[model samples]
Target: MALTYLRHQLHLHRHKIIGFFLLALLSSGQQTLAQGKLKGENLPGYEHKRLRWGFSLGVNASWYQLEHSELYVEAIKSNPDFSVNEKTGIGFNVNFISSYRLSPDFVLRAQPGVGYHSRAIEYKGMPADDDNGIAGGDVTQEMNTFAGELPLLVKYESKRRKNSQMYFIAGVKPSLVVGGQKKGSEYLQVKSLDFAVEYGVGLDMFYPFFKFAPEIRYSRGISNIHKPSPGMFNNSIQQLNTNTITLYLNFE
Candidate 1:
């Protein structure tokens, strides 16, 4: 049932979720036909430069990859921990990029960013019917986090195809999280720092003045964020880590 509900939710947001692929496909088709009569290469001299700077704005969906402990499964079988669920949430980011060209096909980049995110975890169990728990239903704890992120990335670009090029990037992103309910909540404890590895692909479209890149990335955390909870439902969680997918547009 939960999987079905998640599929339905993804279906509702299909455009947002799959827009990057559609754009990439459309641009690939444009590359073959649009460059036949162009005067010179796209961004004629931009790639020759050594230092470049840019800014980006993006939208993201953030969630957790939860790993259940044996205790949690046992607790469920014992009927004290009925079900545990997670719901991903939308997020936004603003970033500044500093780039150093390493070669025609490779570049080193550092992008520092700030992001806002909200994610929820639902824990359903036999309620004690007390103030520590929700009165009427399953306990849903929503956490809003402000993240400071620093990513060191390397970009590998394909040869120019008309006014567009495709690139792949891989990097490490370290984040410091703040302003979450973890500080005072009776349930749902999370650590403040997270580290993740990221990989992505993008299409770079060159205009007369600047370059625009539409990118999609998938990132997974290497560090566990879950902390043991003193309350009933939170105790059932053994491992929780970050999972996120982001779509970005960069102005460079």
Candidate 2:
């Protein structure tokens, strides 16, 4: 009787062990199925990551002027036409963007980059005909300036479902006068700190691996670049200021 009791006990233990394994298998299978369903549901929402480093190349019609220069006004007369002819030129900019998605509607980005700009001013007549002309000079004057610039911009991206986005940006750009010539001779020696306040609007287009941003910005110089002079008619010259408009291409 004791042997029969032992046999029944062994059989009960075996049945319990089998039941536990069956329950474990069912639970594991259910979990796997649930995971598969969740993956399928989320597959469509997953987007590929964008690149962090990119290059930009485009053309810029840049304008450059002297800031609060009495010389310029004396050169142009009381009319004080401060507008420099738009120089049709080209520039290249490269960007390294750190993009973070704050929410579905907002993406914050920081971009720091450098660029090249060229500008020129052509005059219609020789200064010798007027009192402002260099003594005994009869040649028309043309000025060409080349600058190197670095810009930092913080842009606010708009919320939209389309491939394009509109942004407003405020930034600072410091430029160095690399080269300048008037009448084929050195004209103006600029300062080391050429600082400007930059504000602009931009458009960005999204692609699979990269984004293209084209921007138009206006910059106003804070410092007076004009050399002070003593003359009753120098007020118009002293009022001359420097500003610029830039077209830029950004990629990231």
The top-ranked prediction according to lDDT is 1
Q: How does each model score on TM-score? A: 0.84, 0.54
- lDDT for every model? 0.76, 0.47
Task: Flag regions of model 2 displaced more than 4 Å.
Answer: 1-52, 64-114, 121-143, 180-186, 227-236
lDDT per residue (tens digit) for residues 162-225 in model 2: 3455677787767665555322122322343577788877666554445566666677777765
**What does candidate 1's lDDT look like per residue over 19-50, in tens digits?**
65456546754763475356455678786579
Clashing pairs in 1: none
Cα deviation of 123, candidate 2, in Å = 5.3
